[model samples]
Target: MDEVEVVVAHSERATLRVGDMFLKVDADQARIDAEVAAMALAPVPTPEVLWRKPHVLAMAALPGTTVGRLGGPSTGSPGAWAAAGAAIRKLHDAPLPPWPGPGRRPDELRRELDEECEALVTNGVLPADLVTRNRQVAEAALRPWTPAFTHGDLQIAHVFVEDDEVTGIIDWSEAGRGDALYDLATFTLGHEEHLDDVIAGYGTDVDLAVIQAWWALRSLLVVRWLIEHGFDPFTAGCEVDVLRSRM
Candidate 1:
């Protein structure tokens, strides 16, 4: 039997790799549905959906290593970053999916931001003033946006590259219609130093302020979740470091 490697296992979800197959197990059925739907709609390369059960999704593994990791220098060439940028552009321009769910709704997101900010400050997980500043910066991203196909969680690890070209992107559970810049922001967060390389390939005008705002907003909101999931956000170079850089 092929050894089953635990990719990541948390209370809400887990991923395991067995030989050539990657299996995702999540208690949330809707998320699995959204991932399947979005991958079917996206124009960019994505893992091939093999089969799915109520709590499990299986996909054919793609070739190539990940583009990079957060809080670490990317070994990928600038051109690969550009290629990823170009892929994002293509996805954003493609036809919208038949149905985009309640995506980053203004009211809901505001409530979430407020709650998460309060939690961070109250828990002493982050300095109150730092949370306050980032929350304020997050105001820029709270405004309405023309929805576009977004990889909802476009972290660097989700993008795969081979020979300076994007071979595939994984983790579509967060994929949906939302702010295009949000995807860019999430993809570039913790690695702001590479913004220029990405933009050079994106070849389109983007609001830097909004992107920066998202970096702060997303970091602030996800810190608590990371803590609960057995991940550390305050380690030397992690989400907390990303937040501190903004200060």
Candidate 2:
């Protein structure tokens, strides 16, 4: 018998590993449906769905290790990182999903950012200067963007690689049409050193300022949420550090 291993657990969702299979338990069936649909539509490699039962979806594990984890050193080589970038480019180039997906609209995102920033300061979660400076930096990302198919939460941990080749990208609950730069920023959130390598494989020129702005914006918006979800965004090399780097 395979011992069950808790991959991740929070209020909204949890994932468990039993033998070689991963079981995702989500409170929102719509998110699970979206994830399944996005995986079907994505051009890149994705895990094979073994089965599904209402809120629980079981999937065959993909081969290879995650590119990296936030707050940890990336074990992937430059080639692997470039391969991840190439995979992301393919996903972005794919046709948009019929549904709006999970990314917030610019106006909506602005409101959320402002509210989160105010709370962070008022609740003494972060210093006023830090919040203010990051807010200023984040403003650049609030501008309109032409939408592209995006892995809405393209965190480094979601991308898998083996021998400098991308094998799979997992966790598609947030996949949708959004700013392509946001995906890039999310993938390299704390690993900014790899941006040039990713750009080399992305095979296009992108606005560095916009990417940087997205970093601040993403970090600032998610800090409180992360804390509430039992994630340590304030850890060294994590979201808080990412915001501080902008200051």
Candidate 3:
């Protein structure tokens, strides 16, 4: 993999391309190694290849820029969204090994929401009452479902496409067993206009209200993050618009 000199190396991960191997470094490789192994054992059409050694090397490369960089109308096209849904279905259908990490509990999720909301309120980006109300809604909506393996960060940026089809998914660091709807929620909230397409692609008759609740919760979560980070008011205001529309 050293054939292509290191072009970019972050503190936590490095990107290297040598021949057919595109390697990414993980300070903690055990989880990723397990995830990859699980993918291999399951019947799924994912990226092919493996590690040369733990933290020493890993390899797999597919041709195509991230879907995010290919900013065409196609990014939000029905075909693209359908492809993404199909990809997610494949992942969800894969048999996951028993997860070992501290899973996201309702109380823990609530605590995180409260902390983020409090930070946003303290930063003067949100009203205390609004945060409280959103928190309540989030807690209630999340109560009905049990956790499952979810792609924690399932945004358009993480999707990969080649020859007009989704070929592979990247960034396995956030992969974990969590509320399955959380993945669907992220996809739908970010692509509201394509909700029908996404739902159809998933091939499920999910409750509309539950889906909307998840969408609202995801939007509030993002808005809370942006606000806490002290982003420009314009950015925060745009997030507010998204959050409001869902409610």
lDDT of each: 0.86, 0.90, 0.60
TM-score of 2: 0.97
Q: Which candidate is the best by TM-score?
A: 2
Query: Which residue runs of candidate 3 sit more than 4 Å off their true CA positions?
Result: 1-21, 41-43, 50-57, 64-76, 100-102, 127-133, 219-241
Q: Name model 1 segments beyond 4 Å from true.
A: 1-3
lDDT of 1: 0.86
TM-score against truth, every candidate: 0.94, 0.97, 0.72
Instruction: Rank all candidate structures by their TM-score, best first, as comma-separated numbers.
Output: 2, 1, 3
lDDT of 1 by residue, 3-26 (tens): 998766789878787778779899
In candidate 2, which residue pairs get closer than 3 Å at backbone N, Cα or C atoms, i.e. clash? none
| Pairs in steric clash, model 3 | 148-178
Please give, for residues 1-247, the per-residue lDDT of candidate 2 as tens digits.
4599876789999878788887999999998999999999999999899998899999988789877788999898999989988999998999888988777878998999999999999999999999999999999999889889998988887888999888888789998889999999999999999999999889899999999999999999889988999899989999999988998
The per-prediction tally of clashing pairs is: 0, 0, 1
- The C-alpha RMSD of each candidate to the native structure, in angstroms, is 1.6, 1.2, 4.6
How many residue pairs clash in model 2? Answer: 0
lDDT of 3 by residue, 13-120 (tens): 565767776676767777567556545543334556566467645657666644342112234457667767777776776655466333466676667777777877
